[model samples]
Target chain A: MSTATTHTSAVVHPEYDRLALNRFGLWLFFFSESLIFLILLLTRFYLFGTSRPEELNQTLGLAITVILLLSSFTAYRAETAIAHDDRPQFLRNLLATILLGTLFLLGVVLVEWPEAPRLGIVPQEGFGIAFFSMTGMHAFHVLSGVLLLLMVYLNGRRGAYSSDSYWGVEASIKYWHFVDVVWVFFYPALYLL
Target chain B: MEAKKAAKLRLGWIVIGILAVLTAVEFWVAIAINSALLYLAVLALAKAALIVQYFMHVNQLWHKEGHE
Candidate 1:
């Protein structure tokens, strides 16, 4: 019937609604951002060996890596809460996830990075350049995720998201997870290998 | 519905446990193996896959949702 055809068309035509517009735009932006990070990762391996033994033995770097890894779980919890329409739980988990991400970044800058130069490793050093460059780029992503989380929190305070409409939170969570994915690679390259 | 949500939460925690164990294994290999770096890289990749697929729900999203 014409009704059935119309229903199918509605599902396919995402631009017909605000929620669909937000979702479509976010995914498109995310895909492009992913390509940029992929290129950076390729450049990293091109400049440094895929595996480096000495760097793998570092303790401080490994610890910070664990922190970053754990934060991903918290971010997931926040997203899950939002998906299920638990506003208070979503807000709590979102704040916790952001705090954890900020700590991960702080650990990288204050602890792991300071120790790098002390180990006689300068950015000008061959592997050192690739190391700092790749990890530094990932840190920048984390900072952006933190800022995005703050925006989500502000919007949430204004009652912007609900079970039926939470594209903003969903998009922010997607980007945060991408930052986590980048660190998953950077951790091993810079600390484990 | 609440019970289903709780179950999903439990599943999420289980995934977190797997990630933690993999991270520990990475640290161990880096310390124990002579070719530690190579092993560490492999383990790290495994852990990354787990986090992305489960924590990020990339697999679920890709299969069910068209985008976003």
Candidate 2:
């Protein structure tokens, strides 16, 4: 009976299943958050049209957007490696993701944002205020994702996960990827668009 | 079991590729038509759907048999 129970539990308690459930809850939360952003995005578009694109700082912005998108791929690879118990590959991918996310944030703060004053658009300006608020909120999400990834990395180093029990890491990856998804749109809308 | 897991990962990469292509197309349309505003909004929703279905495995979760 004990052996039978072990076999059944092994099948029923696959780590991926638990990870999926956690991610489901997280996605619901994200969906709600996205609705708010969506409304904000629409408002921004209504207020500023194609002419606003000319006002954006595009070069550095597009570069950082590419970085964030690539980071999502790295995070995806890391989760896949973790699912297969490939520790070395998982760590490498996760580290790459962290670096890319950080670079993305830095690009925003140091490079793209400084031009607001030069463009005669202070944060107090209507368009400037909306643009910064929306993208700034998205950046905050990215920062939170970075912190989560750090925790996942530390826990992974401690062997807190395995091929059979990695719900935490999986959930972290999901959240990180969601942040990436949000930025993909935010970048083009706020900068290139 | 391992093979099934590997297949899932492959499926994920395929979805990612499709997303990349869609994004490229959106970028192209934005450039050609000079209307990044509307195109960006639509592309954002597509990208969100891809992440939700492929990366987050929302479809699998919804199909799950029971709730614990």
RMSD vs true structure, all candidates: 3.4, 4.6
Any runs in candidate 2 off by more than 4 Å, and if so which? A1-21, A49-53, B1-13, B36-38, B65-68
Candidate 2's TM-score: 0.83
Off by over 4 Å in 1: A1-4, A7-31, A50-57, B60-62, B65-68
Q: How many residue pairs clash in each candidate?
A: 0, 0
DockQ of candidate 1 (2 decimals): 0.47
Most accurate candidate by DockQ: 1
Model 1 residue A98 lDDT score: 83
Candidate 1 lDDT tens digits, A1-193: 9999989988886543655455556667767977877787777678775655364337677676777767777777877787788888888888887888889889877776786777666678766777677778888888999999989988887778876667678778878877877777667666654
**Relative to the unseen true structure, what is the C-alpha lDDT of residue B39 in candidate 1, on a scale of 0 to 100?**
78
Q: What TM-score does each of the candidates earn?
A: 0.84, 0.83
